[model samples]
Target: MIETVIVVLHLLVAIGLVGLVLMQQGKGAETGASFGSGASGTVFGSQGSGTFLSRVTAILATTFFLTSLGLAYYASHKASAVQEAGLPDPALQVEQVAPAPVLSEDVPVIEEDVTPVPAGEDVPPAAE
Candidate 1:
C-alpha cells in the first residue's frame, strides 16, 4: 500500500518536473540578450519569474529523484504476491517440503521382544 502511494507520487512529480522544465526559458533568451544590447538592463524583473520558476523546477527535480530511489528500494526489497515470488533468493525462500518418513529395505527394526505365555497358568513375576 505504501509502495503504491509512492509510485503515484513519483509519477506526479515526474509530470510536474517535465512541465516546469518546458515552461522555463532556455539558453540565450533574456539574461544574455540585455548584456549584448545596452537598450535595457534586464538582469532580474520585478516579478522575478526566472529565479522563482527555476527554484521550483529544482525542487521538483529533487523530489522526482527521491521518489525514484524510493521505488527502486521497494522493488528490490519487497516480494510478489505469487507462488514463485519476486527474484529467486534464500532469505525469502526455502525448499518445498512434505511430512514423509524414510523407509529402508534392510531388516525391520523392533523396539521390544514378545514371548508366548504358558498354556493356562498365571505366571508369577520373575525376580529381576
Candidate 2:
C-alpha cells in the first residue's frame, strides 16, 4: 500500500513538473521592436523579474527530485512479499545444501613422464 501511494505521488509530481515547465515562457520572447525602441530593459516586464509560473516551476522541480529519490529508496529496500509467513529465516538455509563430495589423498592416478629424452634418440615403439 505504501509503495502504491509512493508510485502515485511520483506520477502526479512528474505530470505537474511537465505542465509547469511547458507553461513557462521561453527565453527570447522579446528582442523585437519595443514600441519606441529606447531602452526597455528586463525582458520579462517593467517589474524586472519572473512571475508565478517561474516560481511554480521551481517548486515542482524540487518536488519531482524528491519523489524520484523516494521511489528509488522504496524500490531498493522493499522486502520480498512472496516469502511464506511461517518459513524459517533464509540465513539458515545455506547450512542445509549437501556437502561437496570428498576425494581421498590415497587415490591412485596414472601420470605420463614428460621428461625430455636425449635430442637424437627416437621414441621407443609401443608394446603390443
Most accurate candidate by lDDT = 1
Report lDDT (Cα) of residue 66, candidate 2.
85
Candidate 1 whole-model C-alpha lDDT, 0 to 1: 0.76
Estimate candidate 1's RMSD in Å: 21.2
Model 2 off-target regions past 4 Å? 32-49, 79-128
Candidate 1 on 1-128: residue-level lDDT in tens?
99999999999999998898888786657665556555244455533357888999989989989999999888775544332564465566777999797777786987765576898988768768
Q: Which number leads on TM-score?
A: 1
lDDT of 2: 0.68
How high is the lDDT of residue 110 in model 2?
A: 80
Question: Candidate 1, which segments miss by more than 4 Å at Cα?
Answer: 31-48, 79-128
Write model 2 residue lDDT over 27-113, tens digit each, in one string: 554344335353346565543244767787788788888878887887655433324455565655766688898878888778977
- In the predicted model 1, the residue pairs found to clash are none
